[model samples]
Target: MEDVNPRIAGHYDELAELWDDIVASPSRERLLWETFEGLLPDLEGKRVLDAGCGSGFYAARYVERGAEVTGIDLSADMLERAREQVPDAEFVQADLTQPLDFLDDDGIDVICCQHAFSHLEDLSVPLSEFARVLVDGGVLVVSTHNPVHDYVVVREGEYPTETMPGDMEATVETESATPVYDETERYDIVWNSGPDSNRATYYRRSIEGLFSPVLDAGFEIRDVVEPTPDEAFTRENPEIAAGFKQDAAKSVCLKAVR
Candidate 1:
């Protein structure tokens, strides 16, 4: 159950162009695209489905709000920068932990999956392939990593506060590897992204591992949010909005439905 897509596709294929320059830097992405554009919805003709679509950065804003996007991912160098940023959407090269089969069933209507749902090792196999290609009132959204404010970091603790009881090797630029969790899997974390060493890994869960497998893969939650730092992102980072108003919600955003 720990495939972890070849070291999460060699850590985003080595930070695919510094992650599209920190998502087009708005003073280092503070209002994360105006809090994911108020959790989207009225995407004109809908159909959406950006699922893990990394470099497309919310699939070129859901194809400039007229929807009908597609975008999938798993880094073919972040789908060649999400097909040069949504050149009329539809860039594939899938693998959201497998089994999408080029979509069909209900045939989508909206999925999103921004911060790639904590880089899933298993989230009921992409929430049961997003409830078999959505459609019944479809609407997923997702965004993640807020297991008590992005795995409880306060400073200088250098990860592994309690999870590694077996496999180890983390290093990175000096080259060690093997990360995807160990100690009976205390929700995986592994770091090294900023200074270029590039070793990444995600999964943190717990908020019932992020909404009980999307309510047992059927979906219906509706809205959860938790995002903050607005006032022009707390005046362009007041110490990261005062450590995000004293921690515990570095990001959450949910929405569901299907």
Candidate 2:
């Protein structure tokens, strides 16, 4: 188990302003928002939950669609930034590690976790709880870090060193820093400026990891989507876009129902 709080919150606070820039562009975020929105059964007047809603990117979009949206996350700084970014929506600072505390059983219509689900160490517990929280047949939307490309690319000034592993899977490790403030672990950021540095204690999920525990959690996997530039972007930069596509390593969206 990672610290699951305070430390992750701290790191996000440190990177709050630039998190989106480093993650993806506005257009890409829009595409992702639309992708997640399409996963829902319907949007208007639905009670939606934005789990790990960093900076409220997808949160705002859901609110725009007339969904009663509540954005929850481990980072207060994140919720703060989200509040400013989308003041109309409600924000809750909470951890996704255990069970979501504020939500009730069978109360939510849809839940969206963008680029957030893949970071957990213990999926069985939380996923089960997630299913518990959702109304019968309600959808649980999870977006994961496509491990291949996400763990590849080594841009300078981004991290400690540039080393691309031949294998596609990633290993989870922890910090020896005394007392280990949150038991937080680290993933080597592929293109980071910090030498020998790694992103703190977050897990990168695999395909099997996606579905196995999902079934175990009593949910059915309805769809798995890999977000790309669509045919249009792929046509303009066939090689480049295809290269990005080749990895299947960027992100994956899984729509599951209880």
Name the top lDDT candidate: 1
Lowest lDDT sum, 10 consecutive residues, model 1, at: 174-183
Per-residue lDDT for 1-258 in model 2, tens only?
435455556656655676656445522554455576577777688888888888886788788888998988887777888999889889998777777867899888888888776567667877877888889989998877654434332211122111122222233332332222232224433323222322444554445655688899899899877767677756755654655654543667779998
Q: What is the alpha-carbon lDDT for the whole of candidate 1?
A: 0.69
Which model scores highest in TM-score?
2
Candidate 2 residue 67 C-alpha distance from true site, Å: 0.5
Superposed on all Cα atoms, the candidates' RMSDs to the truth, in angstroms, are 17.5, 6.9
- Candidate 1 TM-score, true structure as reference: 0.31
- Any runs in candidate 2 off by more than 4 Å, and if so which? 1-4, 20-27, 147-186, 190-198, 235-242
lDDT of 1 at 135: 85
Which ranges of candidate 1 are over 4 A from the true structure?
Answer: 1-46, 55-67, 70-80, 90-108, 112-115, 119-136, 139-197, 213-218, 221-258
Over 1-258, each residue of candidate 1 has an lDDT whose tens digit, in order, gives 557677777677766766766666553255555666777789899888888787887687778888888878877888887887678988888888889997998988888887787767578998999899988988888767666654353121234311122243343121123322221122333443344334566655557767888999988898887777778767865765776676655667788887
